[model samples]
Target chain A: MRVLGVDPGLTRCGVGVVEGVAGRPLRMVGVGVVRTPADADVADRLVLIERGIEQWLDEHRPEYVAVERVFSQHNVRTVMGTAQASAVAMLCAARRGLPVALHTPSEVKAAVTGSGRADKAQVGAMVTRLLRLDAPPRPADAADALALAICHIWRAPATNRLQELAAAHRRTPTPVRIPKGTR
Target chain B: MRVLGVDPGLTRCGVGVVEGVAGRPLRMVGVGVVRTPADADVADRLVLIERGIEQWLDEHRPEYVAVERVFSQHNVRTVMGTAQASAVAMLCAARRGLPVALHTPSEVKAAVTGSGRADKAQVGAMVTRLLRLDAPPRPADAADALALAICHIWRAPATNRLQELAAAHRRTPTPVRIPKGTR
Candidate 1:
């Protein structure tokens, strides 16, 4: 399965595409950052981001899109921007009818480095080794984006299995139990 | 001038259109709320908001769009949703080449009533009185949206004048003064 990962930010939204499934070697289809000028108005910046993301979507056409889920507990000043940017990314993916998944920072880190508390350098190193690239993707954001994609690819199988089980359970009728006084 | 005001929220996005200038009788062109299911996913909610805002813009053909500026200081649980919805509203307006203006809640209240700290009821009452409507707009959010449009219409004149002065200042050359011992 091919997946596009987005590490959303107003100033620099990182995007990367990874192709593979669980327990298999992955290939880096494409990776880059969508940069918006800091001096631009917020609305204009969002427009730029939308265009950039749309271009990426048109070029890569991944089956699933994974985005870093933002939490308000992060840096107070930047949390709002992150949330807004993530929303834009998700909206773009959803508009195209692509399934979108949100993974937390720790989840991405844990998937890549085998530790939830791994540092940026560790994530970068792991991505480089896993993708067999000469070097890690430039900018920590880019590495994080790749990590998100890898995480989604590795976790999807388990998630799908659990969903299937839930569906089966829902389809099964609940057995009726008669109360003692109900005749 | 015609302005479409948006009080954005994931579950209930309030939209209203007002036509008039400062110190004149304002007309309420339209007022309503675009609601999404509470259980809907975030990305879907944003799409709904974008569609709703676009419909309002197409119907009213407003010269300007006013959206409530979301701040991080709001209720923690809902602020993110509010921010995301506002982004979609702003994005839709910007994409259509309509000038988008963000008005803070305090600014809207101050423009409608005389106090920045005025409660929702006061602002709603003022919006009703100003629009000469028999009753205030329902759902408080709709009234708040109308108040936003009114605020923008009232403040645009002063803001334009200030912008003009700033532009003039930029156009003016700075006078050179020689320092002591420097020819």
Candidate 2:
């Protein structure tokens, strides 16, 4: 399945698309960054980002969208902006009825390098090697987007299986029986 | 000017519209809450919220949209959700070409109740009095939204002046002089 991976940020949001299924060769469909000037108004920056992502969505038409899940960040301002951008990505995917998956940084790192503590250099190197590119994408964010897409393609089956199991459990809930007792 | 104020949250978002200029009586054009189930998926909830805010913008056609600026909260999850919702409000306003303003909670309280530390009850009472409503609106969120509207109407002029001054300064930047000996 084709997947669009979004590394959402206020000043520079990374967009990458990868197409493949598990145990199959993966191909990089596209890679780019949507940038807004640091001095621009927040609302205006978001509008630009919305337009950029919309354009990417229209061009790529990926079956699934993967976004980096934002954790509680020490810098509140930074985290808030990142979270807002992440939600914008989700909204774009939802508008098109495409299922969206959120992968944490550590999760993506582990899936790509087989280690959760992989550094940016290592992650970038792996992305370059895996995607068979001549050079690692610049500014880390772009490579990170590709990594997120590759991670989702490789790991999503497991997550989907778990979700299916949970849904089945919900459909036919837990059974309870009373102990036999004298009338 | 007419203002649509939004107090954004995940479970229940407050929205209110008020119209008036400085030194004039403010009228509450609308006040209500948009709700989503607490258990709903985050993406789904956000979609619902986007639709709700879009509808409000379409119906009210306010000149300005004001959102409560989210501060750093102890609960990261809660704050992130609020930030996401607030961004949605801003995005809707930006899409419609309506200018957006973000007011801090303390700022709204100070504008409405003459005290930055004013409690919700006091803010609600003042909002009721200011809008000449028959009674204080139900659910503190709705009242807070109206308070935000009033605050934006009352406070925006000064803020606009400051921004204008900054922009004007930028247009014709400060002159630099070098000492005769230094050159």
Candidate 3:
């Protein structure tokens, strides 16, 4: 399966696409960074992000999307911005009817570098090593994005059997409870 | 002087411009929302934000720009987004040689509602009341943007004077001391 991984940011976003399947090595399809002009307004910056993602999606047409989930909650303003960016990613995948998998930063690092606390430089090195590239990915964001894709490939289940079991449980009927007063 | 206030986001950004001098009643010169398609990429979203800000600057020629400073410590992803968005605003102002001011969320809310802990609804209500508007601004982001302008107007002296002092300090030379070990 082809997977599109995204590292979302307002000014710069890193996107990577990789093709692979279970028990198979993943191959990099494309990787790039989207940059917003420093002088642009917030509105324009957001537009830049959207256009970049669209271009990437059109070129790759990946079957699955893997995005980093927002886990920090320190600054309200920061949290709001992240929420908006995450919402955009979700909307993009949902619009295309592509299944999305959200991965935590630690999980991604752990899968790629064998350590949950791997720094950006370490992660980048590991990605370069794993991809067997001559150099590390330019723009740390892109490397992180690639790592995210590799992470999902390593961790996500091949089949939706677990999901099906959960869904079946959810679909099971519940017996009505009689209120004490009514009884 | 005209001051433009911005509340940056990935999906929607709120922008407002107020025309007046310090201590004078500011009039709303322009206000609007810039939106990005949910399915679009991050780069495209940023472009939209830039275009919206550029359009507003071209139309209004505001002398100064004010933006909210994002300060998230927990969520790295969210913090990165906010930092990117904030960088865009700063760059826009710098490009036009307009001085930019950043206010914290609590500071803006405190200035608008006399309470740092004010909620969005409370801040919105207070902004409407302060502006003598018949209805509250639609989409909380817009109201917050307007509030940021109001805060800048009311607290301009504090910020301006501090900036002046900092500039003066930078210009003044300090005595250099040689370390005893070096000597």
Task: Report how far off residue A53 is in candidate 2 (Å).
Answer: 0.6
In candidate 3 the C-alpha lDDT for residue A50 amounts to 62
What does candidate 3's lDDT look like per residue over B1-183, in tens digits?
Answer: 678899977677888887776666667777788887866545455556667878888998988899888776445654555554555555566667788888999999999888999999999898788777778888998888889888888889888999799889878989899888996
The lDDT ranking, best first, is 1, 2, 3
Going through the candidates in order, their DockQ values are 0.62, 0.59, 0.07
Return the interface RMSD of model 1: 0.9
State in Å the error of residue A43, model 3: 16
Better of 1 and 2 by TM-score: 2
lDDT of 2 by residue, A38-107 (tens): 9977887788889999999999999989999998765888998998888888888887888888999999
Provide the TM-score for each candidate, comma-separated. Answer: 0.90, 0.91, 0.55
Q: Candidate 1: global Cα-lDDT?
A: 0.91
**How do the residues B62-163 of candidate 2 rate in per-residue lDDT, one tens digit apiece?**
998889999877587898899888878788889777788899999999999999999999999999999999999989999999999999999988978987
Evaluation by lDDT, superior candidate among 1 and 3 = 1
The CA lDDT at A11 in model 2 is 92
CAPRI-style class, candidate 3: incorrect
Stretch of 10 with least lDDT, candidate 1 chain A: A158-167
Q: Worst 10-residue stretch by lDDT in candidate 1 chain B?
A: B158-167
Worst 10 residues of 3 chain B by lDDT: B78-87
